[model samples]
Target: MPKPLFGMAVAFGLLLVILLTAMGSFALFDRLDPPPLDKLSDLSVEVIDRDGALLRAYTNKAGQWRLGIDLDQIDPEFIEILLTYEDKRFSSHGGIDARAILRASWQLLSNGRIISGASTISMQLARLLEPRQKRTFKAKFWQMLRALQLEARMSKREILTAYLTLAPYGGNLEGIRAASLAYFAKEPKELSLGEAALLVALPQSPEARRPDIAPRRALAARNKVLERMATAGIMPQSEVMRATSKPLAAVRHAMPQLAAHASDRLTRENPGALVLETNLDRALQEKMEAVLRDASSKLAADLSVALILADGKSGEILAEVGSPDYLSVARAGWIDMTRRQRSPGSALKPFIYGLAFEEGLIREQTRITDSPVDFGGYQPKNFDMGYQGDVTIRDALLMSLNVPAVALLDAVGPARLMERLKRANVSVTMPEGSDVGLAIGLGGLGITLRDLTQLYTGFVNGGYVKTLRDSPAEASALAQATSNMGAPILDRDAIWHITNILKDAAPPQGAAKMAIAYKTGTSYGYRDAWSVGFDGRYVIGVWVGKADNSAVPGITGRSAAAPILYDAFARSGLTLAPFAKPPLGVQEQDFADLPPTLKQFKLAGLWASPSPVPEEAPRISYPPDGARIELSRTALGRQMPLIVKLQNGRPPFRWLGNGRVFAANGRRRSISWTPDGQGQSTLTVIDAAGRADSVSVFLQMPPSAP
Candidate 1:
């Protein structure tokens, strides 16, 4: 080897040794760690609707309104502008910039004050990740070291993203997203040239240039960024001039408060989660919320309203408005009325009529008396205080005759209707400890708007009960909402008949009624007015009343709730679908073509033929003889009450279970019994003629398999 080459090699060895020693000596760095990249991006828990639109957002534990943001979510122009204004070579540098540092040092020394910053975007990110109040050389050195470490562990994009994620904007705002929305009332992707420049300016001196507090300063600072962009040639000088012509936001707007009740409920349901996506349609929710809010001004001061829209097919809740105003203390708008239990008046009549159709006990043309009737001292009168002596079941339902409903309920037995509702997964609170009676057919019971709307889905669907859900992707919640415990509530023919009757009922004044089938209900004493409507696609339920249950005079269901219901269907963009075509075995006929048994429904009691068929012996039909019945048993070994229904049975009858007489009533066809244990037992029923029928059965717990 040449002597000069050997000398050069020796010099390189000494420099390498000095570099190693310097690195080792600086190894004892500050204990402060970098901000967790995952945590910074996972800032707040947000409730999003079905369309992935934001409904509500909750602040982090530190009470900071830091929303998560993505690099791609921001406009490319803004990204470029941000890069040029902050660090022109951000993508190329590791963490620190040596040339920029030397330039800043000379400027500081020459000017005797800080004129320019030496920190690259990455170094600034390190300072943000572990913020410190001190402005000392040691603190800056530590931050620069952390920046190098960040460059080693993260990609260039990751480094930039961390800065974007944790960058301070103004007030409590941090990151590009928070600034964009606070100053511009839009997402970062929608920022214009001036808006982008303004956002870029705020982070440098957030409080000093905040538009809300310092508009003139904000404008001046924003123009400075525009000038920088012009200097960098990233944005044209002409565009910067035009951008300066743009106005700055004079005030900070509140974050979106849509779906307030749903967000509150869901956040509580899923605590500690960073995101709580729901199934609400953001557009529809906002539209309906506006509808209710607008209606509030026309309504009484203390009155509030709640409404919900659900998809009939999949049963997802598309929109929910819990109250007219969330902050109205007078209206008690903070209460989530959709989940509140309130009486449903005439709205339940459709189900009552459906049960009669399901049983083949009545036809549409069947004549029913709507005159004043006293059922064991309980008298049912119409809202008009007059009676239509005899009307078809079809007209009776349309006009909402209270007497006809109670009289028919007397025929069907209100208890049976309650059973059907419970079977269809509807919850009803019968005046505590009180048995369901004829009065229950006219809003004597209580049910939540959520459950009642779900129940009304029976008419929209073909008799099968499908559970309502917020988000189908949420399996655990879906499981609870849809336990599949519901059995068939009515046949397809039965549901069709009910929808057919109500679909043509008159809509509210000035509102053109579509092919939607809906029912209006007013709770007794005018405390609640409700209307639930359904096309083949959507089911909407609306309630108008005081949150305190104060009676509002003349607030009938048709007069109050029906208007909102009809207006909602007209305004909501959802396509209304036609009801299902009459299914097979559905007999649509005039009075002459109907069967003799269904031609004239006896409103008084059970059907008693003028002439008897002697050979048809009275017998038990349900829970057939010697059949094993798996009762829904509790963990403590108690069983749900099971009813034994009879066939061809006379009115005056006696029922026995386990050799103990439980029911000895006048002409009742079915009786309920609770068993002591799961084993073989005899169920016997005897008619007035002493004709007895018995069935032996074994009761066991239902299978626990999912």
Candidate 2:
């Protein structure tokens, strides 16, 4: 080199030494403190319906509404505006923009204050991952170093995704998805020009310019973004003007809470799941919820309702409403009534008839006596206290006569009826220290609404009951497992007989008699009223009652729950699927055309003798002599009726309450009597033979009674 060249060589050696030392220091810093990539994995758990509609979402463990996002899930126009306003040369930048940094430094020196920031999207993301409390030169330098490391380990799209996911948007909300959903009530896949502009402005000063907290600041910031887009030629001037004219959202909306109970259960079962996809139909769920709310509103106070709509063949739960109003404290709405067990009343009658048919002990046309009958000491009577002397098995089941059901249950042992239900995976809870008895056919045992609905699936699914499932993936797995290990709950012929009789059942008021087979059940004292029905493709079960197991004065399965079932089928938006055709060897016959053996359900020594025992006097079985009774009141402060029962009572009976005639002539053993007032009273019942039984009791009123 020349003299000038010697000086140039010395300067060049110093420059090269500085560059080598800087590169070595950068590498050492990167290796010692890598970008915290694992922070990106902490995202909000989401629960969605069948069509990918959000049902519910939960915040992260840190109480931040951080949701995962992807580049493709955002509108292209929003992305363009974001990149143009944040970093003009973002696509070509290598973690840090040297030209922008130089311009910022010159502007700071000239102005004596910082006017603009030179932070790229990558640097912003680095700061978000490891947030610094103070904005100093050392913090900025560290963020720049972390940005470089992030660029080396991840692609540009991945970096953008992480930025969008972790970006703050006022309050606890983070990410474009959370902000979009809260402010716009929609996804970011398709945002309006104004909406996109608002979202682009939020992350810069999330707290100060929150649309919900400070609408004017948010609007000014959004207009600034739109004006910049117009100046940069990213958006047309006309579009910018239109977007600026639009107002910002002043409040954040609540997240989707459709199928709250179902979503809550799914999240609890799968705690680690980031997203849960269920088989529920969002539209159907909304419709059913509205129906239940409307119906429950008309009911007595503190009474709630539950409904479930499922595919009978596939067992996919399309809609599940745990209560009419899940937040109502009076209704005990927090409890999931569909999973709670209660008495089924006569709802289990069809299954008992099916068991009898399967054992060749009865036929649909078989004449079964519905008259009063006493099995040892357990006497059963009809619901209305009036019974048809002799009726066909179909009539007995359709009418839900208690005596006939008990007779059939007695014919095909209650244990076997229980076993058949258990074979279909139906769980029944018998009373403590009690064996299966004839009264079980008349709501003697406890069973959940879910299990009862499952048992009814066999009638529609050709005698095979499927396991009900709400989650799509879990349903598929369970379906596969059930297919391999399941057996028919009833034979094909037996199911056909049961379905044929129930299909002719009368519909509730205002419901079109579609080709649906349904059965209604009213538990003892009306504690629980249930109606379960199945069309060609779907099975719907409705439960209406008090969650505390208190009685409703006039609630019945046919009146309270069946109307909801019929309305659900109408609003389901699904075409009524036709019932299955009769299976082979199944035929409809009249009573006289049947063989001698199948003409009637015969049980040796089971029928009561015609002669009455003079030694046994009529006795009041319930509210035993010298007892106290607690009765609930109606919503209007009217007292509910008290049911008085009698045993060993002959043909007609007379009931008197406190010397007042309650009933002049009653044929049944069970009578309903409303006391004159809540106090001590004597109830007297006289049989046809003039034999009398009396019970003295005190009626207690509820706490709120006046």
Q: Evaluated with TM-score, which candidate comes out highest?
A: 2
Judged by whole-model lDDT over C-alpha atoms, candidate 1 comes out at 0.77
- Model 1, position 290, has a per-residue lDDT of 76
| Alpha-carbon deviation at 660 in model 1, angstroms | 68
Residues 1-706 of candidate 2 have per-residue lDDT tens digits of 5655555455456445533554566788878877787668889988888898788888898898888777887899999989988977778987877667766765665567898888999999999999999999779877777877888888989989999999999999999999999999999997999999889999999999999999999999999999999999988999899888877779899877788888888889887899999999888999999888777655665888898898888888889999888888889888889899999988999888888888988888888777767687777867665566788888889888888888878878888888788778767898889888887889989998887888887877888888777887765665556532577888889988898999999886546787788999999987999999998778999998999999875577876788788888887888888888888767898878899988877655856834544646778887788777766543222354666666775767888888877754376665657788778999998878899989899887655411
Q: TM-score of model 1 relative to the true fold?
A: 0.79
Off by over 4 Å in 1: 1-26, 30-42, 472-486, 585-587, 605-706
* Best-fitting candidate, scored by lDDT: 2
Would you list the clashing residue pairs of candidate 1? 651-667, 652-667
**Candidate 1 RMSD computed on C-alpha atoms after optimal superposition onto the true structure:** 17.8
Clashes of each: 2, 0
